[model samples]
Target: MSADTSAEWFDPDTTTFGDRLAGARELAGMTQEELAKRLGVKEKTMDDWENDVRDPRAMRLSMLAGLLNVSLLWLLTGEGDGPGDPGVATSYVRGGIQLMEEIREISVQMKLNAERLVRVEQELNELLRADDAGAA
Candidate 1:
């Protein structure tokens, strides 16, 4: 993952509330079990929240934001101050970029293949039409 100057890389607008929560938690160097223990919630509950299956109540959300060193608004809406820098390594960033590029390439290839399949199907239909006409 090379350094990307695009706001898409870190823009809150592109992320969901759960994404913000998980990112903040990771930046705080806390695991789901650890955070759950601190919050007096079950690990499954934490997982559900992080996975966007459920949301925390107002008070618990506030506490979670504070514990993760993020603003409640940011955690909820990604509008305010977010988590502090987690000191992500350049190599990791580069790797992520590479993986994203690879995925994009694969997507393009898949689209092309789909298009080719459609064209083949159309040709086969045309051939069948011609064969029927000849038989008639």
Candidate 2:
């Protein structure tokens, strides 16, 4: 948690540079292979960076921050603008689920309404035919 009681997505006290790197990469919706390919590094190299077995060069670090859409300072120290708190992600997922459920309900209602409309049309056609036959 920070000074204001908001839980940070990444706590510098407990997490290492590798942890931050991996977290940011995942949030960016990237696999290690994709990121490594974009960064012109081997998959093993990216794994090394994420495993704390090696660090990136300064230029590579800058590219990484830009590619991940996180501030370089945050990537290094977990203090500046990075991914927001984990709560935000949870809320987003919850909202998505609610929307999906609503859509499903609406779809069921529409199907029922369509069936009723078909029945009404058939009844109307039958009445018209009976009237025509009586006139004839």
Candidate 3:
């Protein structure tokens, strides 16, 4: 847990340098041991970095950024939009907005379904009531 960052930023595409390292490992479907194996690093060294107990040197940072397909500027300063952006960040923002709109539409449909279920239940109850009255 980084004191400076939100937990929502656990993805390498959206976090500070150290946290991004952890996220990149996850995105690559790598355990710390697996990452270590690939990087020729000891697992303890990887752990130390993830835990924020140590920082990587420039060469290691460069290697990590390249390996993860992210920008050094993003990894170092968290300054840019993200790795998913092209030369400019407009497309990423547009993509994110589009995804949000999609989720909103789904949410509206879910609410409508819930309301329909309630109406169905009420109709069934009325049918049962009518049947009981006729029997009595």
Cα RMSD (Å) per model?
Answer: 16.4, 17.8, 16.2
Model 2: colliding residue pairs: none
What is the RMSD, in Å, between candidate 2 and the native fold over all Cα? 17.8
lDDT of 1 by residue, 1-136 (tens): 1235322335666877777777777666678998888676899999999889999976577667657766678888888777656444111122343345445655766899999999999999999999999999
lDDT of model 2, residue 73:
90
- The C-alpha stretches of model 2 lying farther than 4 A from their native spots are 1-9, 85-136
State the weakest 10-residue window (summed lDDT) of model 2: 87-96
Ranking by TM-score: 1, 2, 3
Q: Sort by lDDT, best first.
A: 2, 1, 3
Q: Model 1, residue 115: what's the lDDT?
A: 100
Number of clashes in model 2?
0
1-136, model 2: which lDDT tens digit per residue? 2344344547778888888898777666678999898776899999999999999977677767767767779888878877555434211122343345445655766899999999999999999999999999
Off by over 4 Å in 3: 1-7, 10-16, 81-136
Q: Which candidate would rank higher by TM-score, 2 or 3?
A: 2
